[model samples]
Target: MSKEICFIADSSGGLPREILERHQIKEVPFYFKFQNTDYYCENVDYTGSEFYRHMEKNPEDVPQTAAPNVNDWLGALEERYVRGAKNFIVTTISSRLSSSFQTASLAKDVFAEQHDDVQVEVIDSNTCACGQASLEIAIAQMIESGKAFREIVDRVNQAVGSVTTLFVVNNLKYMEAGGRIGGATAFLGKLAQIKPVCEFIDGAVRPVKAVIGRKNSLKTMMDLAISRVSDWSRLIVTVQNAEFSEDADYAVDYLRKAASYSGKIYRSDLGVVVGAHSGPGAAGIGLVEASPLLR
Candidate 1:
């Protein structure tokens, strides 16, 4: 008998509508709050570019984001289950970065209790935005290829270690407001025009290097990403931007010239959830090895 697997991810994944519709993937939106007004990330009311436009006008008002409600996850799971999905593979942003993973896990438990015949697995992507999206895409493909649940889970776990995410923000103020950097550090960095290159370390975003300009910051980020990949021929890259399409385009061009990857390079918006904290002019690259390295 064939298994019906349902794929779900949070809005933080930054997956495009085509992928969602094509793969039948369900997304739970995160909540964005600006000046006491709440906006849903998945809703049509606010888009990533619109959110950045609002921020440009109210530079002082920092937007905040909240994970999807537990009920949202439960609803998604139950709805799909009722539609004849016997297995569920849910992916979310890093557990260290947000509570969505915990929320999804809880929802999975509740869903399993109500439907004892179903199997639900919640994957902590250990990264956000394009990183999560890449994993979701890979998982969906595996499921379509008739991979078993245990095999799919193992592949995802291996992909976690093989993926590398790097990004740079134009303004440190957003990072400071989000508590990713200290006020003093943000102040000093701004004074010196220092741009920090951030990377995911053990599921948490951390500033790994600092450069003098945006140009250098992008170069540093790309270099750091390239250094980690043992073989560029087996690489899948995702370039994400927060209202910085020009820069993202340039980065993609540069990556094409610099790397030897034979896989597809996905371009995506940073999404409102991460864009709220990264602010405008933020660009990132997520690299995933197509084949897992032997341990």
Candidate 2:
């Protein structure tokens, strides 16, 4: 029999459903409710387009997501275990951002007690949405290439630290709506058209810098990317958001002009799971590869 290692990820992994299905990866999606109709991310019950349309019609219908229960996680692992998957690696959003990491870790420890021979490694990722998903995809690719479990795990840890996401919101409306912006700053930002640059630092979203104009916001992000990147040729840029394709394109253009980009540029849907927090006009560029985190 061939060596079997399975990858299990939560909805926040940000990988497109088709790619996950193509690779046969297991996904335990989070829950969202719309107009009393329940939806699960990456589930057949609800789709990306449908979720966005629902949000458009009902902006007050803020979709909330909850982490999968321990049983839910155990069920996914057991299904793979029966199929001869002796080892499993589960990637989840950051513990600081969500309890999913904690939930997955507890499930791993509990499941390990029942099956001593099986090893389940849970990664916090210290990221959310596609940023978390990109790390999971990297692990899946390495496993598919026949890399050893230990080697894959080590590389994953390194990549987690290396991955960085920079978000530039078109307006502070969403942040204000989400109560992330304070009364003082929100008022000032709105009046001045000041775009705040937020990033995933360590495990949480923190305001790193601010720019006066959209152009500067884009430039600031690109400048940060260029400064952090060493070998530009190996860099892979993943741009994500529902309504900011133009911003994504502009970021890619800046990178092309400033650095070496050998890897392909992938644009992914920010989806409702993240849109709820970042808002509709938010655009972000996530830079990832096996390297050190740029300070």
Candidate 3:
């Protein structure tokens, strides 16, 4: 008999609430605090729009994210384990960016004795925000289609490599404030009206290049990302993040021109978890190749 399977991921997955519920996946929250009141990432208590607005009103008040604690995982997992899940797959943000992977892994070890049948597969998505969320959704689809545990894992691993994320920041102020860029680079970028193009390469967030203006930066990001893929016509999905109306529109208009994609394009907030790192006024595009099973 096949084992009963369930999907799990951290809040960094950044999936829309409805999609997450539709897939019946569980997400452990990452912590974020505002005005001395703490809230879990993705919790309705705090919305991306609200957080972004707060940042706008108080540019100096940069929020930080905390990894889920052992108890956070334990409490969440215990309820699910009781529901008869025999095997589990939990994916999280890059270890280089956060410690959620380690926390989840340790929690699995701690609960092994009581839930021996539960196999927790902790995946380091190696990308944050919607990029990580996109991977989780892909894996969830694989599981729901009745792929075996090992098969699903192998497919997810392959998908991870296939996944590529490229984004451009409207300004370097927030990143500079968060120390993502050096003082000199930040200063020069501000003076020159330079927009930074960033990508998750080799499991690390690095600035690939900078452009003189937003329009040029968008074109360059699209060109570079499209160049990496052999068949833009085969692209199946595109996800975007936007804080300002113009930034969102710019992403949509530019991405449409860059690739010949055939599948549905979805939009999601950058979310607080990712926003905490990427900051507001960030726009990005991620494309997932057509699944062999679907084809």
Candidate 4:
């Protein structure tokens, strides 16, 4: 008999609420401290726009984001177990990016000790935001199709390589605060309107393009991403924005026309995982190549 697998991911997965509800996905929240108050974040305390606005008003208050506590994980899992969930797949943001994967791993061991009969697989998605969302969405489809547990897990592990995550930020201040970029480089980027088109290569961010204007940056990012795939129709794509829905709309429109892509695209708000670093007015596009099993 095939296993009845329940899917769980941190808020950073960037899954739209509709998808989350439809799949019965239990997304664990990440914590961010702002003004000495710890906010358990989903789409964030006040959405990306409000958070960024607050950041602008209080430039001194840098939100400190951390992984979910292990006890929190145990409680959530036990809640599901009591209600008949015996198998679970927990996916988290990249290990290189945050301690979410580590926290989930530790929780897995503790959960096992407490409930020896249950099965738990913690997946390090090796990506964040829409990239992580795309992976789990495909996995949920596989589970719905009655795939075995081991096969689904193996596919997700390999599928991480198929996801290409890229984005362009309005400014570099947030990246500088996160220690992803140098203060000097960020200062220069602000002076010249230089938007760095960045990609997650092996779970670490690397600059892929440097366009002068925001619109030009989005176009360049789309071009660079589309060039990597042979058929856009074979991809599961997601457009995630941090207070930049209009720009994300532009990205979706561009992809549809340029790539002849006519598949369902998830429009998501940037969650705390990537948003805390990418900050406001950032737009991200993630493409996941769908294999035969996922299709």
Candidate 5:
């Protein structure tokens, strides 16, 4: 691990444990209130998919996820700072989806107030899950190559603009309840039995199109994601799902047969906080054109 810099992200990214350990990435936990009585910390008490599975039994739960406060972010940064890392790169979920970005920025401000000789750069990745993980991995590579902190920060922001997350939403009710979509829009989509394709654009989830069925929606998402790829020579494709691993596997197979990518394919789950808004049965293809410091 580089003692000069540290990389941190909220747990909503659902980054694999191996990657987190290998990259020395620190994850700040997000919280969710279960049954209006119990509080569960995401990735600590349960995962993204696990949340949906529990919801299956209840069937009437509305998600109430909370972002880590300034203190939580401060504590995470302080831990790394105490370990001799003067530079911190904090990545948060889209500012639109959650207030994590703003909270993390506040924490950075607090760190700056106390420490005169440290750098903290927080990025609103405008994405979550696989998309966020891609950005984290790329920054880790940059750190390992001994890149300057400023260069890595610039690269991180540039990479955020390159994130394309095309998702298949099985139901729109969850989005509507979470304020991601309007009631009329969700009503109309469900009324027609339409499987919607949503895109994470400019830190907001917007409807892209309507596909015929769930299977077709999965194919359409993958097709759209691959079609938009500027180049495959430096690309990372991730297929992630919320309680739908079989569909994720199918999407991966389709990606393999469709085109050749130099970078690897990641299989991941949407995090609990994100999954609550996206809802169960949501699957997505995260396509990131690489900005790497070391191959």
Candidate 6:
């Protein structure tokens, strides 16, 4: 008998609505606390833009994010299993960044024990936002190409190491409030107009380079990312902005003129999970090379 595979991701994966609907990808949402009230990350009650607008007005009370509990993961998996899926491949934000990966793994174990016929595999993307989305999209393509389950799992695991997540914040106040950065660093960065180009290294966010302005920061990130690609034609790129469509548009234009990458460029909102910390006006580029060209 042939096996049916289902793809699942957490809210931090930053997948757009169309991709979610088209691929039939299931999601578990993360929760955030705003002014003592709890709000789910992708809930309709509070949209991404609305979350950012609230944060902008209430700068003192930046929202706090919470990873989905094991029950949440199990619920999503159970629903898919009831719908005739025999195999599940779950991807989540970096384990180092959140407990979602661990929760998903635990849920898989429990669910598999209850249904001996089902198989569940959890992957720690080791990246977030579009980086995670890119990996999920690649796996969906593999599924469409008729790859075996074992081969798909191995390829997805290997692809995690090749994915790159990079971004620049317009203001560091949100980061500082979230305790991701020191207040002194935020203050100094603001004073110097230093927009630091950051990337995920070893599953942690780290500053790679600093530029004087937002435009330069975006360009630097794109140039550095493009320089690492081995095959431009196979490149998968995602451009995202935090309540800043103009900046996202600018990045898309820059990618066309600068990298000359002809592949489809996935564009999405940064989403509230990342947006809460990145703040408004932030923009980023995520690149996943079809094959790694460098160390």
Q: Which regions of candidate 4 are displaced past 4 Å? A: 1-3, 43-49
- Which pairs clash inside model 5? none
Worst 10 residues of 5 by lDDT: 286-295
**Which window of ten consecutive residues has the lowest lDDT sum in model 6?**
286-295
Error of 5 at 262 (Å): 6.5
Tens digits of per-residue lDDT for model 1, 1-295: 1347788888888886777878888888888888868565554567777888888888999988889878999999988877898888889999998999999999988888888898888999999877777666777767777778877887798778656888899999999988899999999999999999998777889889989999889988887887887876656678889887888987887776787545678888887777877888999988777665221
Candidate 6 lDDT: 0.82
Candidate 4 structure quality by residue, lDDT tens digits, 58-157: 7777777878888768877887888788899899889999888888889889999988888899998888887788777787778878888888888888
- C-alpha RMSD (angstroms) for model 6: 2.6
Estimated TM-score per prediction?
0.94, 0.87, 0.90, 0.94, 0.94, 0.94
**Models, CA RMSD each:** 2.2, 3.2, 2.5, 2.0, 1.8, 2.6
Residue 196 displacement (Å), model 6: 0.9
The lDDT per prediction is 0.82, 0.74, 0.73, 0.82, 0.82, 0.82
Residue-level lDDT tens digits of model 3 in 110-228: 87767766777778887877567667666767777777888877677767766778888876777776778888998999899999889987667789888999888877887777777
Range of the 10 consecutive residues with the lowest summed lDDT in candidate 2: 286-295
Q: Residue 104 in candidate 1 has what lDDT?
A: 96
Give candidate 3 misplaced runs (Cα > 4 Å).
1-3, 35-40, 231-236, 290-295
For model 3 the TM-score comes to: 0.90
> Model 5: per-residue lDDT, tens digit, 164-247?
878887887888888877888778878778888888888888889888788988888888887898777767666778888899
Report the C-alpha lDDT of model 6 over 26-72, residue by residue, as the tens digit. Answer: 87888887777856656546777777787777878778888999999
Could you tally the backbone clashes for each prediction? 0, 1, 0, 0, 0, 0
lDDT of candidate 5 vs native? 0.82
